[model samples]
Target: MAVSQTADTEELMTCLRIQLYHPEPQNIFSSLPMDNRLKQEAEDPVRLGRAAEACPFVLNDTKVSRKQLALMAFRVPGSTEMRFHVQNLSRKGRLQVNGIELRHLVGAELPDKALIRFGRYEMLVLREPGDSETHFEVLFERRIVAPSQEMGEGEARTVPVMESEDVTLSWREPINEPSESDEYQNC
Candidate 1:
């Protein structure tokens, strides 16, 4: 029983990690808290912004426009196995990879070691090295109690486990191809 519980806990471990970086002025290192539950519950495309109260990963880029949505991360569809794709959410700030603008690229594959910059902030996207199960399910256990010497009440039943699957707002648009732009060239 203990071994099975341990395996379950390990299964809940984070599969992906997003590291934050900034230039000389804002040199800070931080990792976003990403868990299996958050990934499983998130919509197709995950939204990110600067607003602490709004975005899943609240970015602290003062140079970023307050009205901009910042960025969007999503899992590629049409296959059982999928990789993450990142796109710029703001039209003002360009998402650059290797000093090249990402305005033309459909979506940059994540878990990439290339330097990523937007506004005054830079980021490194990485994945944890481990075997992970793609299937996700929530389990529930129920229990019943009888009135003998334990309880004064006649008969009582309790739900020891409960699973919730309510879908919340992810503030993300459906993953799609980028529009044609003559201004920015492909990187």
Candidate 2:
């Protein structure tokens, strides 16, 4: 009985581990290596709430500032998209990337096409009316990229991932050029 109990304990441990650490498909992102994401189910209500909120309508920027949004970071999300989507509940506001107005940013999936080519473009969203001011400064950061008298560094190089169209095509040239056109030209 003692040996059997020890065997059962080992099996239970193995089963629990598999449940806790399933990978692939939708892998959970974490700052921890050994820590199981399942164990973090009860960690933060606010964060969970934010994720839930953001996933549907709030789904835009991974992080949002509650204060002055003086700086914008229009970096390529990967080797792909250079624009990031943001939801501004601030009412009557202007968001500009490197002085380029972000009116191009719309829809949940479409970020502004103009904001699509910056290593890290800086933006300033000025709220003129409605909502509140407390939201601006708390969420804002310094220019995403520092502006200098040396402006050469500000040139945008990031390309939008979604805007890329497949241009690779194969064409079959006329095996005998003039078989049709040349015979007609003789007339």
Each model's TM-score? 0.47, 0.20
CA lDDT of each candidate?
A: 0.40, 0.24
List ranges where model 2 is wrong by over 4 Å: 1-84, 103-187
Q: How good is model 1 by TM-score?
A: 0.47
Compose the digit string of candidate 1's lDDT tens values, residues 87-181. 66665767654343555223455442334556655444443333233522211111122111132222111211112242121222434568877
Clashes per candidate, residues 3 or more apart or on different chains: 0, 16
Judging by TM-score against the true structure, name the best candidate: 1
lDDT of 2 by residue, 79-176 (tens): 32222233222223433333333332221222322231122223222211112211211122223243321244444322222233631211112123
How far off is residue 29 in model 2, in Å? 25
Cα RMSD of all models vs. native, in order, equals: 21.1, 19.6
The candidate maximizing lDDT is 1
